[model samples]
Target chain A: MTLHRIRGGPRLSVDNDRCERFGTCEWEAPGLFELGRDGRLRYRRRVSDEDAERAAAAARCCPMQAIVVRGVPG
Target chain B: MSDGDRIVIAGAGVAGLRAAERLRELGFDGELVLIGDEPRRPYHRPSVSKQLITGAARPVDMTLKSYTELDARWRLGTRATHLDTTQHVVHLPGGEELWYDGLVVATGVVPRHLPGSPRHDPRVRVLRTAEDAAAVRRALAASNKAAVVIGGGLIGCEFAASMRQMGRDVTLVGHARAPLYRFGPRIAASVTELHRQHRAGLAMNTAVRHWISTKETFGLHLTNNQLVVASCVVLAIGSVPAVDWLRGSGLTLDDGVLCEPTLFATGAEDVVVAGDVARWPNLRFDDEPRRVEHWLNAVESGRAAAENLLAGRGQARPFTPLPRAWSSLYEVRLQTIGLPALAEDTVRLADGVTGFVRAGELVGACGWDRPKAMLYWTAELDRRLPAPATTPAPARWSGPEARPAVGTAP
Candidate 1:
């Protein structure tokens, strides 16, 4: 799993083995997911509570279900 | 359940490859073989139109996984010529025969081009393969001339958007006034607006009567006598199933290989089908069999088919997924759920989501740039929809076991 952190934000987990770089996550949550050059998907593990909805949408929209979110409190 | 059991999967696309992987994941320690006509490994076909064409992704980047990762025999660049159902064998073009206890037909679909058109000509291109996309990219980069897209479907509209973004003059021609005619007038109008926003020319409600080609340039003479001259021509018309190989196999072949509710091929207990080539009755739409040519359906179908292959007929659950597909063009993204093709009436909701109705019921929904609405509607539709009949005998694979409940199937 590829992990990235933003210190005081929700942690994001991306299973590199399952990620196919379709870039659907990028559209759902632009602040968290980025489609880099050569179609590499880069993401920040930590996201603010306000952006939690977008983060969850990214996870749901992913065809491969490669994205997993953690530490988002209600 | 023995290790000696062998499974042969025809086609190395997402459907075929995933079925093999799922079988392994499900503790199937059997011999697995994957065959594909394409030389390269299984890649994300969706990206070939959007990211790959725009130079945002490389050919190698489109691959779903490293071809070397699968624990199966690879037979790339080889066509499965025929299926000998009586002998449980798949005959290849070179007299190579593969015998298996289980079989999966996942040959997918082949791009449909203009009939009688000179496809070998340098100016013509199709975006089905990586090579085809690369060739178009090279052609677009080399010349500053206007490009013509011969279809008004999703693919054609997408290519027009991509090319126009690359600073090329693009003209999109289609028979309908709007690009996506099946999505009703409002959605089509929105798509028309999307292309118009990019200043791409649209010759809608017209047909290409003939092609005029010379050594220097090519032209498409429209029915209205408006000749469209261009350097490159892309046939984004659509595709047909790659089931020509299974013609005499005795399986029901309509638009694709027809399968039972459990994803098994008709009349064949050991044979299953997946991906764009498998036409099974989706439990959501009242048992109306459909063949969805989207990325997610292919993967999920393969995953379900793997379980069905192991569980056999009655023991396996049905494959009834809520159909959803998304496509992005320029800055706008369209997320659709349920059956967009069967929608007869559409109502534009206040939240930018369109409710697609058929027979006085909301059968589907599409959202344009409405991410939040897409999520809500997806869940709403899944809950509100009627459950597919459990008592009626299936078209095939009808057994003694009781049908499973909705959402619990597969």
Candidate 2:
């Protein structure tokens, strides 16, 4: 098995301190990061490849530079 | 990801990231190096009010994308100093230079610093960066008596609402009459009403001419010869293209980079500029090169530049003009579609909902808790509706205003 996962993704994280919560990432990636009840943020449970790209778009579109994406464990 | 064909990008904002994503989608499998001066991943700006100021969110959780997933060399915290576009090389601030076959500069705009104020003043701030938002958020926690917002545009209005919610006495001072009067009177009214409803001070048609500095207090001198005192000041004045580094570079700069129709530098070259930094003329808007500093425009423009870089002239689709942007402030959802910047008239379809329209079609609209009305009006905008009896100024198109001798929906 290839140790490194391909371009597929199932993970996302954000540096909350740096996040202005601008919603650009959420606009770009709706299925990934859900603004919780607190209006803060949390990742959805399942993130497929297609939705992952959208999430990536939102993450890239974020102006505050506050997300970190991890693939399979390593 | 190999630098299969090394593509150089400057300014690590939304434009750069959107372009990178488009390049990958277009199957440009070469090396992608994204250079940014800010040493962080891209995040959002809209949240500075609702989440960060309310302490509902944090910056780390708000990036547009995580750095690990991007298939690019992250040259973060490095400024691209010079562009020898002719030599196909970009110089960095650290004395290192990199060669490029294609370049996209999404440098974005810099927040206009408060004029005549000491830069090191702890109470002074601008809400552009995540850090800036956090500073403003933190400042409001202690003392938010009267905040002197230097601009009365969308950002200032949105902040006024957020501060009012946070119990901060806010004063929005702008040089324009009623602020954004050109954006449509209804929108300006809606914004003004929101501030008034919250009891915040609205100082439209007013200017922060200068500041009188003292040991602990700084007084803002207004053009009306009035002095307003505040615990802190948040300057939301307009921004300018961050083109200082490109001064000596031969690239054209009429306001921002005067890009050709294809979003390229005036002279023929591999470098391309997008987002708020490039003055991209819209064909639909009479070739007026507008540098819209909105999120949607930034993403759309960035994607177009990336696609062109990947496919050159052959395979890429034409960059259609972006749809006008929308926003949410003070529980009001404001949307602008097409080009309202060139509109000569406005029509309010729903009660309190206003749109700039002309000749029986819709162009730009600002709705107050009525997105459904905006959508219906948007669908009926281009179609031929019966003409209004009046001059079509401030009349509904599909609801109640379109009836004259016929008594149809306006």
Candidate 3:
């Protein structure tokens, strides 16, 4: 459950156990998260500051609440 | 509005919580109050029928992480008894009345119960709250007899699937010819196959005619003259909008609180509606007002309602969301976008995708275990929808003059 943090921006992590693959995160932050054709979740571990808001929105939109964004700037 | 102004939100579910968050995100510094009938803070309700029943997640895991961050007065375990639109007052039980400059109705829905069902019977249960899920779990653990779930809707199906995963003999009973009939024949067939592969019994197109309870087990006599004996029975029939308290409130109530395209309560400028309790016509589709009881609708409508309330009616934009919902059963993941029930014809597309057509146009699409197909179809459906209306930018406020004078008529 360690919060991953990138040097310049926030980092994203999905709890594989809790993630139900709803694909809602992909809709909110397409570049950061995606639902592959194989029914698996594909996401970047770190995102630039410009994508922080969208990443946070994706985390909030997740029904499972499995997505976590760390080191978000105020 | 200044700090003296207040916005009282009724119902503290996901929609209500989202509305409060949006208000704060828009820099609302006015007094904010949330009234919830449930004693606890908002939690993810979908888990009640799935993970909670299977011992995979607890009640604590279902709570929303953002609720604790909102700085608002929480009035939990209290129901809103009455509404005085003219006075802009919301009356609660025990003669408590609170004044509000704006209101958001997100009371959500309550599960329907079967007639002649014993309320005190521990064997019969309904899955709406965390308490209900815990009770169902205890009942299942206590009995070795088969569990009978009386419904074929998503909730019932999920419950039945969870029970099967728990290695319990389960039977799903419904009046429809097949399970998930609202999703169309292909999905229904797929769901039926899934149930069959899981070795769960299906008693579709039948209903309980008699409820016979004994010291050891309960027997459900169906209309088709079959007896289902079980240690526990769950009623997942359906739910209706929790609008009983709004009967004399002067708000238009059909199946839910009727609202304008902007999510404002009809004839009430200062009030808005959201979540499963909101019945508004989606301008992207047609003029018929309908209630979308999906999870995404709660989030989208909640934010829209809050924004419209802050921007005022003159500058508010229409809440035209493409309805979306998803359900998980066994290894199958079903995702849908738009109103599948409104389609006149359904065509099966490649890679486990289904297209819903109304008036020779693609109005909805559903993916069965095909997330990629769903993504593409969702984009295609979005392209078909009318372009979003161009509304003036929301009126941003700063300092004390962010809103009108408190108690002033709009």
Candidate 4:
């Protein structure tokens, strides 16, 4: 009911439009990416500020570069 | 004309070809010319060790794009002999020349060769290209039972898997304490365990000090004073930068063509060192430039190089790669993420030798006859939970650390 929803765990998230889904992120760090009920990617809802660099790696690895993870206290 | 800028890609391997494909998709309008040393189109290099050797897949499985499909100028079978940065030109082996506005060197790496032996011997084989695949196929087909694989790198393991699938006894020799110490220890331990459980001869802490070769077989002498007899020896020790011709080409060669964090070599402002030819620093792991020999690294480097070529120096970013690679040995699939530096923290995630997460991200992963749990965990933790400000690879990834003796193989 907020302006937007961050529904998954904090570790990672992706913007489908931005995410080409190169799957490198998943290939590198699978713990943060999972198949949701819809079989699309679901990231951890709340990655800490500490997890920023690694979370960004998972996002950057996306060939589509579509991953836009927020809320890392950056 | 739909235009960003032209991208002249050198070395038509996975990296080079992928750069072109991504370039077209990314909407580059200027002329796209792909130059290479090989005669055929770029094909998949990874399968050379896995499928091509076993006769399960043909050399064509490595093909990324067909000639009919690519929209670039394809110089089939042509070799680039010289590059002039002052003129922004590339000289070819066939007395041809090309003037380019932007250059991308995706010349991939070649299989490392024995220091003394003839590179093209019937007894010894190194896999890197489609032609190399042909030679490996012939050698493996003739290898009925035993194959002594020198160097337990990813290529070595995949080749070992192929030989073992043919029911051949495989002795995988590595000079390190575990397999793939280059990838880090946790993943290597898991790999060593998997190979052992799968009944492949896992010879760790062993090195092929030298060899005595006959026309029909190779007598492998180990550093530990052990002798291995096999008709064929597949050397998957490692790769050498394919920059032998780039000598005196004015590029700084430190191991590979050392690139700035921005991926530029020397001489031309438009030229970039990509793929295995360029040693670019990875901030994700070590700050020092490292050259990784894998399909993804090649593509990533090529794409970034081309993008930076069009974007210009003002906006370019350093080329840092996330260490990611995978291998198929029989039914087991092993993949890893992160530059698993020698770590101080490694906690096993599952009892099946699945993996140890460094800083809670899937830094290294491995498995046995079956890697179900490991793959699942790998996908789950591709990013660390509570995403840290800085990754944990340099801090958390532990190595030379003690691991339980984990092989069921005699």
Best by lDDT: 3
B330-350, model 2: which lDDT tens digit per residue?
666666656677577987667
For model 3, the stretches where C-alpha displacement exceeds 4 angstroms are A1-7, B1-4, B397-400, B403-410
Candidate 3 residue-wise lDDT, B1-410, digit = tens: 22336899999999999998888767676788999999889899989988888988888888886621468999999999998888889999999999998899999999997888875898799989989998988888788999999899999999999989999999999999999998899999999999999999999999999999898899999999999999899999999999998888889999999999888988676899999999998999988899999988998898889888888877788899988888899988889999988899999876688899999998898888887778777888898986467677654434255553222322
lDDT (C-alpha, whole model) for all candidates: 0.78, 0.67, 0.87, 0.64
lDDT of 1 at B31: 72
Q: Candidate 3: which pairs clash?
A: B1-B402, B1-B403
Docking class of 2: incorrect
Error of 3 at B115 (Å): 1.9
- For the predicted complex of model 2, DockQ is 0.11
Arrange candidates, best DockQ first.
Answer: 3, 2, 1, 4
Runs off by more than 4 Å, candidate 2 = A1-74, B1-4, B66-69, B138-144, B314-316, B358-361, B377-410
Where is model 4 more than 4 Å wrong at Cα? Answer: A1-74, B1-6, B66-69, B116-120, B143-145, B182-189, B284-286, B342-345, B349-410
What C-alpha root-mean-square deviation, in Å, does candidate 4 show against the real structure?
A: 13.1
Q: For model 4, how does the per-residue alpha-carbon lDDT over B1-410 read when each residue is reduced to its tens digit?
A: 11224557888886787667555434454568998778888766666776677776666544553211246898878878877777767888767778777788877677777666445667577877777767866776775647877787788888877877877888888878887766556567767877787788867787767778776677778778888877677778788787876777777777888887768775557778778788877655446777776566776787677666655655566665555555666665555545445344566666644454455544554444323444465445445422224321211101123222111111
Tell me the lDDT of model 2 at A46: 45
**2 against 4, candidate with superior TM-score:** 2
Candidate 1's TM-score:
0.82
Best by DockQ: 3
DockQ of each: 0.08, 0.11, 0.38, 0.04
Best by TM-score: 3
How many collisions between residues are there in candidate 1? 1
Interface RMSD of 2: 15.9
Candidate 1 lDDT, A23-66, residue by residue in tens: 66875788799767555778988777778757866774586557
